[model samples]
Target: MTSHPAAEAFGATLTPGTRPTVLAVDLMRAYFDPASPLNLPDDGCLHSAARVLEAARAHDVPVVHTRVSYGPGGLDGGVFFRKVPALAQLVGDSPMGELMPEVAPRGDEVVVVKQYASAFFGTTLATTLHARGIDTVVVVGVSTSGCIRATVVDAIQHGFVPLVVEDAVGDRAPEPHWANLHDLRTKYAEVVDEPTAITYLEGTS
Candidate 1:
């Protein structure tokens, strides 16, 4: 709702549906570990996402998580792998591809392995959500300008309402983080904080 030109021009906002699901996108070691080349700025985003996960579990909401991985030599990944050399470290048997313990998926949760930014790109995410009767997707995870943004867009395109938890999504730089959040809030999804998302998940909103 800022006075930005784009926000004023389009001003589209997606409202969350009653049957909501939690989607933790790409909360993996490579983005959380400091030693990894893909490490993000800090762990604040992870902590916020963990809180949302706790709320989701408490409410017995369908929780889905995504991790990016590739087969040996990244043959499964075409141009994407070649464009980002750092992605080579995530292929086959690499610890970097594993989801971080902070926001790990539970036994009954769905874990979608994808090579691209959108969870719905080459996966059965949309179909699975449809089968589960899920209408709203409460999203949290790393790199807001990347997978988070892509997932939000795809979620809306696939006919699911996307609600992005602002504090739970981070980026390599603050500028892109803030910028993408603004754009997402203005158009694609409903950008919210962790508390707002949890309230909605609990059906109190």
Candidate 2:
């Protein structure tokens, strides 16, 4: 099952966590709006993500969401905001920053507001999941090479298994998207498909 020489030699890879939690990150309007520079172009990931969310809800798994927000002038955004000026769209009440209806969190789901790419950074995500005894995080959302990748790496470091759904994460370009997913599958997380994710959620509750 190994895809690389080292992996085949050592058989080192990630595994799925038995107790599942659905984590939807940055499913915001900016990524879906063609006019926005953050637009992902292929919106199919949204539909796949919505399906995974629905399955999670049906099975009664814990759910959490993360969205980026910056105060006026983005002073709180720090270097990240300076590097990506386009993130300004997420500031305040901009419609582009709102969660996409397709994957928006329902009442009672934890909504984490963060300034950086990793959901666990500057947020209560790790402690919250750890407190609940959630062993694995099923992640879905935008920007495979950025936020998704960052979150996956941290999830494992924090002891929560990270399962990144390939069909449910998007990037501006295919190269970074595929490359990150590939590296993650071998190193940090188990990069699965939408069907596998749904199956995992269905088995929960």
Worst lDDT run of 10 residues, candidate 2, spans 7-16
Model 1: CA > 4 A from native: 1-8
Candidate 2: give the clashing pairs: none
Local distance difference test, per candidate?
0.90, 0.90
> What is the clash count for each candidate, in the order shown?
0, 0
lDDT of 2: 0.90
**What TM-score goes with each of the models?**
0.94, 0.94
**Global fold similarity of model 1 (TM-score):** 0.94
